[model samples]
Structures are given as C-alpha cells and as structure tokens.
Target: MVDPDRVLVPTLGRPREDEALAYALETFPDADVTLLAVVTPLDAPLSEGGVLERSEERTARARASATDLLESVADPTATERIRVETADGRPGTVIPQYASTEGVDHVVMYGHGTDTSGFVRRILGRGIAATVVERTDEPVTVLE
Candidate 1:
C-alpha cells in the first residue's frame, strides 16, 4: 500500500487507541498524524450554568489527556508532524467529518472485539471507530 500523506487516528482514551496509534506511527513514519478526540456532551441533567461549567471542564480534561497521550508516544524528531485536536460532537460523525475536511489520506483505528460485550457495543454504535469507517471514503486500517 502507498504510504499516506496524512493519517487520522481517533482516540477515546482507550488502550486500543494507543495500539492503533503506535501501529500507524510505525507503519507510516512519514505521514502527518492527527490525533483526534471527540468529547460527547454530558448526559447528566443539570442547571444550565452547571452544565456549561461541566462541559468546559470535560473539554479541558480531554484536551489535556490527549496532549499527554500524544506526547508520550510521539517521537521527538517527528513532533512537527504530530497534531493534537479535539471536537465537540459524536465521534461517529465528527471523526469522519474531520478526516474529510482535512483531506486525510487514510485512517488507522482499532476494531471492536468479537466477544459478547464488544458485539453489543458495536450494535449500539458505541464503537465509534467502526462508525467512522462506514462514514468515510478514506481507506481505513483496523487493528485488532
């Protein structure tokens, strides 16, 4: 396969995300890697003020965590090519949208397992990576 010029990897603070990232880094050393995290709106019902504050806090935390994760795995020599980004929306929609808008050449992500829980997650669309694959035209490489 041709090495991609830009690769999008959606992370959800999961080990599988790290695995997919590591794989992408190794496989496409020259590709610009965009580390994306989607922060879904909180499901809790609360006063508007409280909701706004909580949402801000969640977004900050997710951005910090994503930065840390990217820093931990990114090679210093490639720092210029690694980007940390976050969006407020469902990962299913946002990931693909981001990839398309950014002109990503490919996507590398982890696949939901075949076990019972994984199956349920996939059915419920909790596996955002899978959803991203379905929504984007870019080639996707799914890691087990």
Candidate 2:
C-alpha cells in the first residue's frame, strides 16, 4: 500500500482485461504501467483471434493483443507512460517472477474466470491472481 508508482497489469486476452487495465490507470494515474501477457501451453481449442495457431504464432498474437488492449483501455487523462510485454510460461509462475525481477510495486489483475474451470481449480488450487497474491511480495489488486 505504499501508493504504487510502478504498476504491473497482467492480461489474458479476456473481456475482463478492460476492467483491470482501466482500474490500474485510473487508480494510479501517475504510475508507470506495464501490460504483460504470458503465453502458456495451448489446449485443444486454444485460439487467438478466432483461429488456431502454433506456439510461436500464439506468442506473437498475445503480444499484439496486449498492446492493443492497453492502448484501448488506457486512461487518456493520465500522463504516465505505458509498456507492453510478453513471455512464454504459466501465468501463475511467470507473473510473480516478473514482478519481483522488474521491481513492480503493484499488480492489477483479474481473478479466476471462464478460461479456467471449477474442477480444475478444485484440483489445482488457486488461479493466477490468487497464486500471484500468495507468491509475490508486491501488493496485488484483483479486479474481478
């Protein structure tokens, strides 16, 4: 709660991403914001832009989508700079590690959503935001 000046917003190309990104910008209008999209192993029906693609293609698409989403939702009233980044790994692991290594003070993210099923959570425990909250030292703001 140190009045975050370095904010990290992790997105998954979901609709809820608008809320998280906007909240981070509006809440910390002067903070430097980074929008990250972690590309994980694909499942059977995994698709980017309604078309299935390979891992490399998927990673590229994720980056583009993250940048586009950030651009669309960013607060025009804020004067802070915004960045977009992408990594290849599981969100629960990569997000926290990135936050630690990059000195991210605040993390604005979404809770478990339609992408993950209930049975999966029951077996695997917490989702991305919950896992990051449990693992990272940075203060996390889950905008579910």
TM-score of each: 0.82, 0.83
The Cα local distance difference test for each model comes to 0.76, 0.79
Question: Candidate 2 on 1-144: residue-level lDDT in tens?
Answer: 467879999877767887888898888887899998878766422223424677778888889899788768765555348888897777778899999999999999877553677887776666667778999898998876
> Residue 94 of model 1: what lDDT?
80
Model 2 residue 92 CA deviation (Å) reads: 0.6
Q: Give the top-scoring candidate (lDDT).
A: 2
TM-score of candidate 2 on Cα atoms, chains taken together: 0.83
Candidate 2 Cα outliers beyond 4 Å, as residue runs? 43-52, 76-80, 114-117, 123-125
Q: Clashes in each model (backbone N, CA, C under 3 Å)?
A: 0, 0
